[model samples]
Target: MRAFLRVAAPLLVLSAPAFGQGGPSPALIGRGRILATAADCVACHTVEGQPAFAGGKAIATPFGTIHAPNITPDRETGIGAWSDAEFLRALHDGVGRAGEQLYPAFPYVQYTRLSDADVLAIKAYLFSLPPVRRTAPANDMLFPFGYRPLLRVWKWINFTPGRFAPEPGRGGEYNRGRYLAEALGHCNECHTPRTLTQGLDMSRNLAGGIVEGWQAFNITPDPVSGIGRWSREDIVTYLSSGRLPGRAVAGGPMGEVVGHSLRFLPREDLSAIAAYLEGQKPLRNPGDTAPRSGYGRPDPDRLSFSLGGNGLPTGRGLYVAACASCHGLDGRGTASVPGRPGFPGLVGNSALGAARADNAVLAIIHGVPARGGRGESFMPAFGAASRIGNALDDAQIALVANYVRAQFGNAAGSPVDATSVRRLRLENGGRSPLVVGVWAGMALIAGLAILFAARLVRRRARGNGAERMP
Candidate 1:
């Protein structure tokens, strides 16, 4: 470890100057690479199991799927040919490969606040990689909305990209936090709600918004619906442990962000993150107060994973022993928050109620994530905590699995037995889950073709009628 650091130190000092005056330092680039990981840049840009920067990753969205672009230095296809000025322009201004307007889906609005040096460093590190000569798939946009010019309207209403302007009186940490939240970290990308035209509704920044299918919960200081319940220490601990005392483990995209991203962030940046998160507005829930019907509360004190005649118990004994404290014997969750937009009611979570049962069990088996939209790398992974390192016996996993399902709200009558949980655990063991995208482009093309054919048929019928009349 000492030797590697020694080599890095000199390499940075020697190569950093090559960046030209105000260019970039090798050390800065190196640091940026680490920050990029902390930002989980690759999680979206590079699909799981693929080599880095060879883009083919899919992101789900309400409009359609947006694929991450190639980040390598390939001259013909990647950014190899781009100059330092062009690079800065792209990040600071949100322009595309040909200076075309880029959609907000790229999150450049968040990146606009990054320092010129930080942006250059990240670009340099990206350039240092082995170029992957792959072209990104064309964005699947709906008609009258597909062209690049449409973004002019999007920008007119939503975007205000530029370097962050921190308050002079604020401390260094607060300033740093502001920079990250506004620019590179883009906490609001997920947290802020969007309008019908798909522009960000800035009025409700950090108030929790939905993107694709997943919801990015409000990170504000609201006591009822926000992170106001968490102390600064609690936020830090969750960032480190992926588990909170009263709250659950971060899950979904948040898990990938932590395992692959936040693990590399500097301690100071992480601290800055906590500081910023601690200052958001409290959650102001608006809606129909009645809880969604059908999911009934579990009978407390009844802890059995019986499968009719069989006892295929999974994770039961473990939950009773380990999780029964704050969560209570029943998985009913808290009265006001047990089930809501962001805080999914465990008893009746759709993921838990999944017909296959694997998704729900896996969340418990792996751990729930705290991945809401505003930031990346805030969640942590706990696969080891469960001791499922191919180290624990199958029976152990099953005991806890059944325990959570039955205790939570798998069904009003049916219990998720050990056999169900064991089957799921074995099926998904050791595999990294892939993010899926909705391909609306295919549907759009099909619709166009059908329209074309209908026109042709109508023209032929009119000619035939004219000949018959003559």
Candidate 2:
């Protein structure tokens, strides 16, 4: 009996880690893969033409560029040597294997809300990937801002480390949606506006912000500026297919997001996200206003216009040359027959109707492709070095964009200048300069405080010496 007990105990000990609560079963690994997809890990980690998850993609932030590290299981170059506890700390506490503070560019602030089981599941899936030995580029940040220790201060001021707690009395769907939206999906990272300190402003959660030159439109419940008017099905369709007939089409970064992440999500998950967004507190910015109606009616005079009228650059001439064939000189889209898919209408469209002209300009600069599950209705690119249509200069793109906004969108005389177009083109799309001047100002103040403290200490030392001299 004693011999049997000893053998049985050793066997149990050997098998314990595999069957434990955080064990790496096939089901757990599969779940982790789905969660990682929802998190869009590949969008930031996988560089073009590189091995998957080798992680050399450069992510631009207001402070500077941060290169994502290899998360593969390579012992030296990846996370192969990391323990489960270490990985959890990295996700939940934003600490690295060597105890270095990870930059917020990794979105650990949002990831901190994930449960231990979720974190371990992710680790399990990552460990399953083939290890690649490629090293990532070093981060390119400005002086003092590049200091890793400075993150301690940022975390203390901005971070609240805790797993998501389901709100009492809420239905399971709502709670599940909250977990997916707030933690796994990290939707607020793009949609929410940032404070002066570069932290997300919770009061205006999902109220929208510009990310990488594309506007992440408001997803809150406000009728004017948000998706309050959209039904749950509308949200689901947009998430699943990236477009909603007459309303708006996803382009730029959002196109990538839908193509890579949301489209692959199950219908149940998409429904939950819609439910959660619908239940959010309504928030409206000061300039919120509805789209003007009756702007897309046909204009007889402009219908027969020729390209390059009077041999000078005019918005009308450009639109006639570049856009008239598809969108029609009337500004109403072609192929509007019932039961047939049609090009998006220019008038009263959310992309055009929004107070900001950025989306409209962006569509012109970087053409919207057929995405999500929506069938082909491709728009050729006109921006510089475009592969499809003739590459239009910044001025030409601006002219056409402004014309559409005024003539069709009823956003007449809205400001979208050549200079702004040039900047957006040059920057490869814009991020808010939220951290630029603020960090410099803080550094100056910190230096002054240090100098003041040193002076005070010197004065006190001199006073003590005088008192001791008798």
Query: Considering summed lDDT, which 10 consecutive residues are worst modelled in model 1?
Result: 1-10
The numbered model that scores best in TM-score is 2
Model 1 — TM-score against the truth? 0.64
Clashing residue pairs in candidate 2 (N, C-alpha, C atoms within 3 angstroms): 213-430
TM-score of each: 0.64, 0.85
How many angstroms is residue 129 displaced in model 2 relative to the true structure, after the best TM-score fit? 1.6
> Can you give the lDDT of residue 332 in candidate 1?
53
- List ranges where model 1 is wrong by over 4 Å: 1-18, 21-25, 287-303, 306-470
Model 1 lDDT per residue over 386-466, tens place: 333333344555455455544553443234556655554443431112211222454466458867999999999999999
Clash count, predicted structure 2: 1
Clashes of 1: 31
